[model samples]
Every structure is written in structure tokens, then in C-alpha cells.
Target: MKIVEQSGKETGQGRGRALWAAVAVIAIAAAGVVGGKIALKSKVNELVAERGGKAGAVEVDFLGRIHLRDVTLPLGGRSNARIAAIDGRPKILFLNGTLEMTGLDIELPTARILVPHASVEDANLDPATLTELISRKSAAPLAKRIDRFAAKRVSATEVAITQAIAGSEQKTVYRQVNLTDIANGSVARYSADGASFEFAMAIPDGAGGSKQEVMTGSIGQMTGQDFDAAYMARLYTEKAGPDDKEPRPLYGPLSAKAIAFSNGQARFAYDEMRSSGFSMRMPAEPLLETLEKLTSVTNPEELEPEERRAFFGRLLSLADIIGKGDMEMLGLKIDAPAKAGEAEGEKVKLAVDRMALQLDGRRLDAALHGVSMGEGGDYVKFSEASMTGFSWDSTLEALKKMAGLDEQQLETFPFTTLLPEFGTFRVAGIDVNLPNPDTGADSTGTEGYADETGETDALAAEGLMPDAEQEAGADQQTNQPVTSMEKPAAAVPERIRFTLKNYELALTKPFNGIPTDIRFSYEDLSVPVPAKAQDETSVQLRKLGFDELVVSSNIQAAWDEPSQNLAIKDISVSGKDVGSFSVSGLMGGFTKDFFSGDPAMAQVALLGLTAREMKLEIEDKGGMAKGIKFYADQNGMTEDQARGMLTMMAAAVLQQLAADQPKLQGPVDALSRFIAKPGTFTLTVRSKAETGIGAFDLIAASENPMLLLDKVDLEATAQ
Candidate 1:
């Protein structure tokens, strides 16, 4: 309606005309409100439909005001929307809306999770940009591209699909979603029926800082085809903004089915995973930074100069740990403290698998099978293990390269290169009867793994030694003899050393609460002795030698918790070159010196011995070892008349062993005088009986003289 007024300018009485014109203006404003309402109502209706709303309503408030009421946006449900703001802002303005969105509660799977609470103040949200990326990422082909080429190369079985759950304020196009902190908290749970996981996570108040959110409910199941890279390129290319023509590849595709994680941990399933070798210029990751720190955690330079060099070498060894290494079990168990319930790391297994690697040009191929990615992120138990095949081709090639030899020439060398430290591997017990590389027999060295087939044979011993020269005879004994007789049988050299193999040990008994059955082999050890009277006196050490050691020793013990008396039940031992000897003496009547001036006779002197492979178990249960036997001049003993004093000679030697002496007795006491004052040609120890005087073997089949080791200059080396 053309309602025109305000003719006050033409009216002479302007005040009166203005009043009439104001009334006209008010009348026109009332009608204009009706028209503005109609236009705004149409606008609101269009917006509701665009937002998937149905049966929406609009209302106009006082002057130039409009309100939307009970406006529902349909996601298969009904809701309301309200918005209010000034037509043209002069100073302050405000707009607010409350939404109660009921989620799609279909046959969703159930899950329980506890999420730590966190928050952030500034998020710098780019609703528009984020929306575009999200839209692209959620595309059936694009998201599928991420899902398809997701594993480097697509598997015939496995596929991934992602759909928009709750999109950003604007549509987004992403090559692959970098969920960032969201990815940190979110976990994927899926099965092998080509069903990808579709989950809805509660967005945190903010993305970073202390912000955290955990959702515990079934999101959805995805049974769609995976998108390929070509699809991703095509999808993004079509949606590409003004300058998106360059087509940047976001996250690189995976070359292997496994997801290689931080700290060198990896996880993968066998069938569903597709792997293709691809070079990844791994853009700097936080994990790499962390591992670098670990590599330098214990600085080699922290050690002393000489020690530092060795430490540095060991640290360098760890650099190629993924290539040339062995499995050194640090630990395995349930509820590992590190990483807690998260996936268990693959440190040891990877090393073992890498043990057989060879650098063929720049690429490395394992001579053995690659380690299987463990089923569960586990520690103690391995449900599945990788096995290796027999092929020494790489080893042969390495040898040929080094020596420039042909196959015929290489044949001259031993194919089995022995690791001196590792020794030789020989099967002893339960044999898997695996064919040998050379001998091709069950007797050949072979291994049996737990997961595969036949029962495993007992693990074999690893080291073997070359044959040694047998001791010629008692005459072969080293050192000078006192009476010039053949060497003592007890003085034979049978080298001994300790055997330390990994053996399952258990407590059998305790001698004085010290655990027994702590058996160990002692081989290739040497002991020495001295010549004596009657039977040769010697240190018998036939229980230690150069072969397999079998030791059984009982400690000084008692039935009660605390007891004074200590008795050794049995300390039996067996070795290839070792013999057994048992002896016992009462620690009675404390004396300053045993064979010196102040000495007491042992009431019970006992010792038993059995010669090598002989039934000669001889034992001597007899007289005390008098410090010295003297021959007095003519009838009785007078200091001046004694030309050769036996007691003095013996005491002199005994005093060297005994630090202190309280008394002296008999000829043994007299022998101390010579030792106390040296440079005297007194009675020397003899291996045989002298024409008028004598000394004899103490502990040997053939008596021999004692040569003191203290007198030898041990630093000598032959030219």
C-alpha cells in the first residue's frame, strides 16, 4: 500500500503539521512490520530446511525483532533452534543456542574406558578449514584411499572406511586426518571380516594442553571398500581450492602391514595385512627425538678414558642393533611396568631376527626368517614365533667377497665358521631330528621351536675343546725333589675352570641356610704340593679338571637354625681329568704353629684317596706330624753337639707360615732356630728315604719333592 504522508514542509504551521505527520509515520511503521515479518519468515524457513529441519516455526517480537521457536533439525529426530541478534550493531551484541542432540543409538557395541580429565584455554579452531579437510577425509573414496593404500599397499582382505560422525562447523577436505591429540586417546578396535571400525569420540573442550575426553560406547561398524591413493588424489583434486593444484601428499603410505611404533615396537596380523616395500623419509617425529636421547642417555664419555673407548664401542654396536644382533633377554612377564597395559615392545625378538641380516648393497635381508609381530602386546609368553630356513648363501657370498674366491676355492675353507666365544653347538637330549646341514642326520645340530611340530630335544651344550696332551708319568712332575725320586702322583697337572651354563636351578637343601645344589664345573685348574716322610705329603686336588664338572657339596650345617658344629656330609666331585679325595681333621688345641716350635699332636689324623680309575682307595689313619725329628749326637741332645738339628730345620720353615708362636717343643721346636736365623744349610725336604735320614710323599701314589711356588719369578715369558 502506497501510504505517503509528511506534508509538514508545505504546511505553514510546521509544529501542528509535524504532529499530524508523526501520526502518519506511526501508522506506516505498523504496516511495514507486517511485511518485514513475512520476509524474515521465509528466510528462517529456508535456513531450517538447509539444516535438515522439519515442521519449523518463526515468531516476530516487538519492533524489528524476529525469533525461531521449536525449530527441529532432523537426524531422524526432532530438536529446536533459537537465534537473536541486533539488525545493525552499534556497541555490544550477543547470540546463544542450546542443543540436546540424541545420538544414533543402534546396535552399537559396548566398551568401557577411563579417561583422565584435562583442559585447554586456546585452541585456535579453524572451523572452515577443518571442515573442508574433514569432508575430504570422510569421502567414500578419499577416506577409502587412506584406508586402501592405508597399509602402503591394499590387502585383498583388509580395508578401511571413515564417515563423518560430528563434522566441524564447516565442511573439510583432508588427504588424511591428522587428529593430533584426538588420535592419541582414540583406539581402533576391529575384526577381520573386512569390517573397519567406526567410532564417535567425545571432543575435548579444547584439543591440546590439559584437554582430554574419553568416550565409552559403540560408534558403528564399517563394511565398505577401502579408498585407494588414486581415489584420494582424485577426490582432493576435484575439491581442491584455488591453489591446491600442487597436490601435497600428507602422510606417506605404509610399505609393510605392521604399524611400526615408537621405541621400535611394531604390531601386525598375518593375513589381513598388506605390505609393500616403500622408502619413507620419516619426517622428524617426537619418537625419534626420544630415542636419540636414549641412545645418548648413558654417555660413553662419562666413563674413564680407557673404559670410555670400550663403552663407546658397545654403544656403537647398538646402532646397527636392528641389523646384526642377538636376543639377550632383559625381561619377560605379565604387567610390564614400562608402557603398562599398552602394546609390549619388540626389542629382543627384533634383535634375534636381525641376527641373520646381511648388507646386500644398501639393502639388508635377513638370512633367517623375520620375527613375527606378536599377537598380543605381551611380554612373558609368545603365542606365535618366526622360524628360520637353512641357507648359508649369504655367508658364502660374504666370504667370497672378502677373499675373491670362486666356489671351488671357497670349498677348501670350512663352511661352518666357528664363533670362538660361542663355541660349538651340539644336541644332547630331545632331538627334533631335524636334518643337518652337513651330516644330514638326527645326530647333527638342529633346533625345535615350541609352536611348530615335533617334540623338542633337550638343548645341547655349546662349547667343545680340542684334545689335550696327557700327562706322561709321575716323572713328568715339575719342580725339584728333596730326595731325588720320581714326582708324586697327587702333583699331576689337570687344568680346571668353571662351567656357567644357563640351567634351571632349584633348592634341594641348605647347609647352615646356604642353598645347596649350587653345582658348577671347575676345569683346567692347577695345584701344587711338597714332599714328605713315610707317605708323601702333598695338596691333593684331583676333584678339579679340564672336562665336564659334576659337583655335589654339603655345607657346614646343623638341623637347628643356629648351631656351632659344622659338618660336610659329602663334597663328591667328578671330572674327566679330575680324581676324588676326602679328608678331615679336628680343629683342636689351638697352636701358634702346626709344624713349628709350639705344636700339638692331632689325635685323629685322617685322609682317603683313590687313584685314577683304580680301586686303590687308600686311607691313612695314623700318627701325628711331629714338627721335626732330631738325631742327638751320641746319646742325649745338647745344643752344641747337634750337628744337624731336625727340629730347628722344621721350626724354621713352620715359623714362616705361622705369624706368632707361644711355645716350643722337641726337635720341631729346635728347627725354629735355623728358620729364625737364616743362611744355614740345615735339613732339606726329601722325596725318598735317605741312607740314614728320610722324608716321604704325603699324598701321592709316587712320592716327589716339593718346590715352593713363592720362590718362582712368575713374570717370565719364553722367547
Candidate 2:
């Protein structure tokens, strides 16, 4: 009994001691809460004061959540900001926190922004760095500080911006915006929905006047991945000095969908646009300053000539500094309403399936696919077109240098320096159809009124003979004098249907802006024969049974800089149902001075050129027979008689040459035989001299054509 009583007493004492310990713990916790509140408030006040801000009531909860009301802060560089309330939970005392801001309004130097609500989750922010960034202080330091920043997500709702510029007000709005995985001064993903803006600017009207142009645009969705916010801030805020070797900042991939812009007269829209690998080395502030200066001028013509030149120099510099990037757009379209007196629904419509541009250092590339313009039967279309390896560095530098020169200096400038190097340019599968003025309808046929078999019923249909009555009226009109202040009716443009299967030009190895290597070719190029022949050559060609000109051509040439040799590998041209002509040759003594842009230097270089070897071949494909028949019809004689006369005439001319220089007798006889019977002909010329015939010697021989035979060996064949 005694042992149980003693145990009860000890248990009661233990319970009392436990209660006291609980009370002490409660007291310590209460003290800690009170002290934390004071410290948090004090820190907030200190930071607010440091930034030239007024702090309102600050409240701290037991969970270390702090709330501030009616806070006003200066946001650096003529900017002020106000927040109705800010609620946040501190992660590490009072230094960084997850923040929610409501009713935030900022007044900037030239703009005002309003945000209904914004939040940052798991944020780790440095107040000093934040203040410096907001105040437009040095960006280098802020960029460094960005490495220390951490934020999992940031989001805002219904953000709006308004700016007043040069008596014009511009507004922009975003329905919702979100930035996720923000850390180390970069954002993993950023997105915005339902964005729109209005822009107003002055544009020159060609008549020494300026007009206000207002444009409104909208974007359905905009998104970015892996955005480098810190780098962009540094780029915009810092000026690039001469010794600044910092690489261009990268801005990951960005895309926008359902983009549209409209002025009063026209509208432009695209289904989607994407950009990747965007970077820029140029400073933004200077460019923006120059643009602002230019935009502020209501009358651009009023600017001094020096100012204009300075602006041009700045533009050139900007072009030079543009770094590497690529952009692409799909389903691009433009529409404009038809003018008065036009048919109903006759509106301008243009569309492109895809357009892309890429810049890599000094090189630029561009491409367009599935392009079409106009509607219905009258339309222009091309399947694809591309240009690659266009380098503009040297060209831009030359222009920048010229931009600083006066008119007198510019007059003597070597304009050859402005030429840029080009690579391959190609366009394929082009087709065009337009309304023919004569027929007042779409004309797909290339032979005017001729049928598919190349037969015309009327002489006028062949474009050989005009209407007698119209010719008489034209003669009378020409004889009459102008008696009134009136102008004659403008001639209507000839409508033509054109189709090209492919066209390509490739150039490389430039010397003084001239391409040393060149390759140019076009295939299946078709154009309609004009309704009326305008010249004698055209009339003769039309008379040769050519209702349409369907041609294909190719040229390949190269120059060896070290050897000063120019080789024409092949220059060939062929016509459908006609014949083909090809020439191949090699020449020497083409120095760089030939392309020096100085006339005197070019003249000297030209005198030193030498001809090595040349070959000319012709393959007749019924065209020669057609030509013989045409001559017969013109002379009102039989085909055989016409052929004999033509051969005799050609032989007489060649015999005179052979008489002067007997070395040409063989070629002369061969040419005469070829003319008598229309067939394949080949002419070959080779320099007899070991070093080839000089151009200067050839020029001297031009006065006496027979002298050229002594310098070269010639051969001709008829088959």
C-alpha cells in the first residue's frame, strides 16, 4: 500500500511539470511570432525606403505570411509603381518569398501599364537587384544577379499598356500570360493568349509630304520556349563598344498563330509564324533612339542633308550587325478591295503557302513556296523559289562608308564595292494567265488566235499584216496636228500567257564584284507570239512558222584566277520544233583588273585578252527547212530555186573572203554546201600561235577581216 501511494505522488508531480513545460513553449512561440512581425515590417520599410517608396500597413501571420497595403515605389528612371495589396509567404526570413500582387499599376517614362493580378510561385528574389533592374540601372550587374534568381512560375491576367507618342496614343493588351520554370535569368516556357495592339506612325507620301498611317493588329496565341531573359535585358540595356566582343544573345524558339494586321485599305494575315535560333549583337537602345528621332519628324524633307546621311549610316550599321536567325510563315495572305468601276468581287488576292528566311553570320537565305496572286482564270503562280548564300557583309560596309561621303565624294566612289556575293537562285514551275486585251478573256494559248496545229486563217492572225482601214486611220492621225489640250489613249499592255518549268542561276568566286564562276539555265520557257509584230526581226521570226517561242537554254562558264583562264564549258539554246545551237570555248589573259570598275583599267585589260580555241555546232530540227520555205514564199519562187539562190549568195560572200585569205577556202565551201542543204553544221577555230591570238591583234584586224585568218586555224563541216 505504501509503495503504490509513493508512485501516485511521483506521477502527479510529473504531470504538473509537463504542463509548465507546455506553457513555456507557448510563451516562446508567441514571442517569436511578435519578433518576426517586427523584423519583417522593419525589413520591408527599409527596402521601401531604399527604393524611395512609401510603405503602408504591414501585417505578418503565424505562418510567416506577410501582407502589405497601399504601397508606392519608384521603379527607376522616371517610372513609378503602385500596388493596392501584396501577399506573400517568405521562404527564408524576409529576403525572398512567393508573392501575389493585386491591382498593380506602373507609370513609365513614356508608357503606363496596368495589371489586375499577378503571382510568382517559389520565387527567390534579391530586392536590390530587382530595384536596380526596375530603375534601369546598369544591366551587366543585373544580368549577373539573374544567375541567383529562382522562380518556378509567374502568371498575370488582363495586362494592358498605353503610351502617348507624338500626339498619338497607342494601346496594347494581353488577355492572359504565363511564364513557367523561370530560373537562372531564363524562362523555360512563355505563353500569351489574345494579344492585340494599335500602332500609328508617319510615312512619306512620295510628294514631299507625310501622312499618318494607323495599323491595328492581333495575335491569337504567342509562345516561346527556352527564352533567355537576362541576355535580352543585357543586350537592350548595354551599348556595344568597339572592343566589346560579347557574342550575340540567343532567344530560343518562338511561335505565333492567327496573326493579322489591317489598315484601312488592305489586310494581311498569316495562319502561323515561327522563329528559331534568333540572336542579335546590335544594341537596341541606339537603334531605338535613332528610330524615335526619325519618327518624331513630321516632315522628313525638312531634315538637313547631313542628318539624312547620318540616318542612312545608322541603317547600314544596323544591317551589318544583324546576327543569325531564321523565321518561317505559313498561309500568308493579303487582300484589298477593288476600286470603283471594277467588276463585282474583283478584289486583289494574294497567298503563299510558306515563306522562310534564314541568316547565318554574313550569309542570308530565303525561300517561297506555293505562291499565287489574283483569282479565277487571271492568276500568277509559282511552285517554289529559293535564294541561298547571299552574303552582304562587304556590301553593307561599302554602303556605310559611302553614307558619310558628300555628293562629290560619292561621284568618284568605286560602286563595285557595293556588289554582294550571291550563290544559287532558283524558281520552278511558274505559270501565268491573264486577260487578253484583244479577246477580252483569259488566254491560255500561247499562239494568239492560232489553233493547236499552228495554222492561222487570216493574215492578220499571223501578226504579219495589219487591217488596211486601221493602217489608213493611223497614217491620218500621224499626219494630223494636235489642236487641243488632250492626250491620246494609252496603249493597252499586251496580255501574255507564260509558263516556265525551271530557271536557275548559280554564281561563285567573285572578283571585284564580278562572278568568276557562273551557271545559268532555264527549261521549257513558253511565251505567246505577239498579236502584231513590232520589228522586222520579229516579223521574219513569225514568218518562219513560229506561232509561239518555246525555248530552253543553258550556260556554264568558269574562270581560273591563278591561271587567268576563262572557260566556257557550254552555251546551248534550243527551241521546240526548231533547232539547237551550242558553243564551247577557252580564253586566257583575263586579269582581275578587267573587273576593277575603272574604265581605263578595263580597257587595258581587254587589250591583253587572248582566244585559245572555240567550237560552234548547229543541229537543225526542221527549222532550216521551214526557213527555206519561208524564203521561197517571200520571193514568190519554188523551194529549190530559193535554196539555189541563197547558196549562191552565201558562196559569193565567202568566195570574196577566200580570195582575200586562201586559208578560209575550206570553211567557205563547207558553209555554202550547208546553206544549200539544210543540215547540221560545225565550225571550229584554234589559235595557230603557241600562246593564242591576242585581243589587241584581233582588234587591229577588224578593219581588214581577212587578216584574222592568218592568226587562227579554222575548220568547218556540213552534215
Candidate 3:
């Protein structure tokens, strides 16, 4: 549009001058009108393109010094509403102008249902009167309205703030909204950090009010319903949905699909990561509550009686939850408290601490110790996990949570209880003080005691002997007073007394799941059995009162998962170490005991069978005297069948002895001599098993003869 220009001063009413004046005024007015529309439209498009977002037909109208009359952003209409107001004034200097709209209605029906009410403080169009563009252009009103409406439509679905500068007066709220009907929604807000652009996220935690949820994701991604950029891009542009404006279900089920975050810390990579495990240390209180739920522990008062057992077990397992290699990672270190007199030795060093993880193609390996391993072929594998001096107590605390116990339960269940369950005696060395069976240096140590009773001694079976009575009487007489006693109390005299010879035992293994190959051995391990009938002085009684330990060869049988079998092994032991091995950690049960009543039901369960129910068979072939054999006929059988059938129940033999001697009735007090003392039977068997706990094996006879097997440390060793 060509226009003429003229100053009011050189004026003449001539046709040309009049025409020039009129042209100038009209041209300036027209420029003002067109410029306003062009500028506003340009800003809106810039916003959408810059953010890589989508929108619909936009219209903005203005009036007064700084008031907006109508602004129509394409918000999906809630039954059709209209542009409300825009009233922020651009600090215009001189010229006064207004473009007032008399009527306005038509809510946005696309990105959001924005009923915009905006007021620019002072809007003017004069060249010299440009106002401060506070918002660049106000879109908050439209967004806020859209958000409010969205919340009502769906309880689960709403515009969540992908990023927000909260805790401030001028907090910017960035949100993501999904408009299935509109075929699109916006990644909206003034998120300078591009946080709102995240397509996927994982919230660490969420609670009822003021939930502090961390949105972890990446930029330029579309999250929710498995939808991403490529998918949403097509859907939005094509406007494909059940109707023209709605996004089709085909485009939904959208997920961020491994979105990126923090520049490059996170990036979308085809949803390959099955799981990216991350550990978070929460407040200790919450962790305690978690444990309390699993067991019956609530308070300290209830710990010893009920919660003491399971608490320790759960704690041990929980210690493993860091995946066996993260003690250092968790910044846990074991610090032994300084003893009163002892100075610390060289600091203990950590040997191995390694943790490895693999998900999809991503791998995270960390260790405080050197390690080597083959590459993960199909799945990730970690080896060599050892955390030295880890906080046993902290681990127990964690176990409570892992065990699903509440916080209160854990408080009662401390980690100390596990030590007692391991059944380690404070004393180790003791010597057996009995006369030697052999005259020479007592090389084989029959000197330790009577050692064994030869089955041929018929008089020994009568249980009457002056020597036995002398030993019993001597032990009962006070050593210091040197008094002769005509009579001792019947009960007191009945209890046998065996002076403790030095015995030794030391154990080095974890409590609970102590390694099976683990061994507890000592050079001077000695334990006296019931010497005389004095039960009060007997070691067995003392043991029973405490650890309830039994003496015998333990026929141990267990399953080895790796070998896939019922493995057979044996442990020969007799000790005065009696203590309970409960699965509970002292602190575990206390939490539930108070709140939920009684949780003692989950005790150590039943004490398993000991070796007593276990038995052994020995087979050895011997030819009878040739002359006697020629005259008499014993059941004649081949060596092979004889060997095979020789297998017989040891219990049956014990029963036979009990039947023969009526006095040997109740429980068959120790094996008696009446049962046929095994004659030369060599036993060949693949297994040794016990019927119950606290019972094991005792070899009554040897292969050469029915002679007693003493010092049967007939040792077995690993091949």
C-alpha cells in the first residue's frame, strides 16, 4: 500500500496537499493495525516451534492501555466455553491506543481447554511506546485453566509438573498433559532446564500430602502409554484418533521407552534396559518400620522372650541385600571398640569387595578390591563377595525390613543374639584325668579313661566293682578336709564325677548359614562322660543343663544344591557345649510382640534329629575252627550273599540286649554287653543318616573282633 507523507506545517488546502495529508494519516493507522496482528502471531508460533510442541489456531485480541479482550488457545472445550480476559499492560511510554473486541466466545479445543482471562497492564502501539513483555506473551492463564479441567475428567490422569520451581513466589509450573481426544497434549511450562521435556520417569517415593517425587527421565521424549516422539509426531500432525481430533488407541500404550535425562546421564535407547536398579538410603526410621511388619517385634521389653530369634536371621539375610558386595559402597565399616588394656594392632585390611551389574547392554562394575571374571554371556553374574567388618548391627536393622518386620519390632531385636545361637563355648581346653589303660607311655591314650568296655567281661555287666565304688567314693570326699565318710547322700553318691581333662575347641564361621565345609577343631579337646553314678558331678548333666549337647559320631546327611544330591557326610563329636541355635535375632521378635500381640510362632521350628537314630554296619568274614566246623553245621552261605545280608538294624541288637537283661530296659542306658558283640563284619555303605538332632554314631565293635573301638579317630580326610 503506497502512502504519501506531509507535515502539518507546510499545509495548503490545494487538492494535492489535501490528498497527501489524508494518505499519510490513513497509512499510519493501517500500519498500526497490521503490525499488531503480525507481531502477536509471530511470537506464538515461535514459542511452539522452539519447544518442539504442537498447538491449534490461536487468536489474541486487545483493548484499553494494557488489557487483552480475547485470547483463544486451542484447549479441548468442556462443552464449549470462551476466551475470558487478558489484562497485563506493556509499560508503554507516550501513545494511547486500544483495540477492543465487543464479543468473544470459543474455548480452546485442542492442546488444552483454556478459557483465557488475561490483562496486560498498559498496552500501546505507538512506535515510541513499547511495553515490557513480562511473559513474552501470557499463556499461564490458558495452561492453568486447562490443568484444572483435566483433573476433573480423570482421577488418575492429570497435568503433572514435569519440572517446577517450587517454594518461591514466582514459581514456574511445568506440566505434561495427554489429550487423547485432541490427538495431542503439550509439554508445557517455562522450564528453562528442559525438564518438562522428559518423556519417561521414575518417582522414588510418594506419600499423601506434599509428596516429594523426583521425575527421572530425559528430554525430547513423550512419556506415558509407551508413546514417543516418532509416534506422537505422526499422531498429532495427522490428527489421527477415534474422531479426527483424538489420538487413536493405536498410538497409545505410550511409554517413554528408555528416555534420557541430565544431558547425557540418561538417553532413550529403545527400551532395552529390563531393569536399572538403583539403591536409595532412606531415613532409618522408615527402614525400621519395614522390618517390624515382617516379624513380631515392637519394643525393647519384648525382645528377649519372643523376638530374639528371627531378628538375627533376617538381619543376616538383609546384609546380603546390597547384593553381597556393597558394604563399602554403603559406607559401612567395622570398627572394633578399643579394649581397656590392649593396643590396636596393624589395621585390618579389606581383601575383596566387588559388585557387578548388567541390564540390557549397560554394565556397572564397582569394587574396592581387585577381581576377575568371565564376561556375562546371557545373564550377569557376580562372584567373590566379601565385606569385611561390616556393621553387623546396621545389617540386622536392614534385615528387619527385608524380613518384613515393622520398625518397632527391629528396635527390640538387636544383632547380638546371633552370637549365642552359634553355640561357641567360652572355655576351650581341658584334660581327662583318668588312669591309663596301657602301662607304657599310654601312646594311644586309652589313659584318657576306661576308654571302652570289652564285651567279654561278664562281671562288668553286673555293674558291681570295688574299684568303681572306690573311684566314686574318692571323688566325693573333700580333698581339703581329709575326712573319712561312712556314708554319703544316696543322690549325691549316685552322680558320677569325672575330672575335666583339658579339651579345646575354637570355631571360625559365620552364624546361621555357617559354611558347610567349616570345621571347629582343637588340639587338646577332651570331655569326660558320666564317670561314676554321681549325676551332679557328671559332665553330661552339666552339658544338658546348658547347651544340651550330646556326645557321639554325628552321621550327617544334607543336600548340596550344586551337586543336586542328598550328600552323605559324618562328624564325630562329643562335647559339653550346650546352647540354643535359634533362627531369631534377639531384636527381631520384640517389635511384633507389643503391637500385634505374639509372634513367637515363627521360632527356630523343631530341633532336627541327632545322630543317635543313626546306625552303622560292619561286615567281616571269619572261618570257624576247622575241626569244630567239620563236625557242626552253622548256616552255610557264600561270602558275597553273607556279606550283603549281614546288614542288620543296630536298634534290633540294642532291643535284644534289653530283652535279655531285664535291668537294661528303659532307653537302653548306653550299649550293654549282652547283645551279640559284632564278630568280624566289614561294613560297606554309601550313606550314614541320623533320625533326629542331638543323636549321632558310636562304634561299639571293631572289624578284627568284637573288641571295643577306642581312639577311633580312625580319621577320614578329603580325597
Judging by lDDT against the true structure, name the best candidate.
2
Assess the local accuracy of residue 274 in candidate 3 as a C-alpha lDDT between 0 and 100: 20
lDDT of 3 by residue, 1-719 (tens): 12233543334447677899899998986777567756655665565444343433445444223333344333223433233443332223453333223223443222222211211112233322221112234443322322222110111111223222333111112233332211123222111112233322332222333423222343333333322223333322222233332222222222222323321221222221122222221122233343654455555435653354455554453333232111122111222212221225322222223232321111123223232211111111122322222234433443444354556766765443333212222222222232233311222323122313222133346754335467566667845432233222222221111322222232223323222222232322333443343444444343333222233223333333343232344344433332111110001111111212223531321122122222233221222222123223234655344433332344567678767755434434332221123232212211122221121122222333222122121211111
- Comparison by lDDT, 2 against 3, better one: 2
- Measured over all alpha carbons after superposition, the RMSD of each candidate to the real structure, in angstroms, is 27.0, 7.0, 24.1
Worst 10 residues of 3 by lDDT: 579-588
Local distance difference test, candidate 2: 0.79
Stretches > 4 Å off in candidate 3: 1-35, 38-271, 274-645, 648-654, 657-719
Candidate achieving higher lDDT, 1 or 2 = 2
- Predicted model with the maximum TM-score: 2
| Deviation of model 2 at 316, angstroms | 5.7
Q: Work out how many backbone clashes candidate 2 has.
A: 1
Q: What lDDT does candidate 3 reach at residue 48?
A: 42
Per-candidate Cα lDDT values, in order, are 0.28, 0.79, 0.31
Question: Per-residue lDDT for 213-324 in model 1, tens only?
Answer: 2221111222212223342344323333455333232222221122111212222122212211121111122223334444564654355544554333433322222222
- TM-score of candidate 3 against the unseen true structure: 0.20
Question: Pairing residues by index, what is the TM-score of model 1?
Answer: 0.19
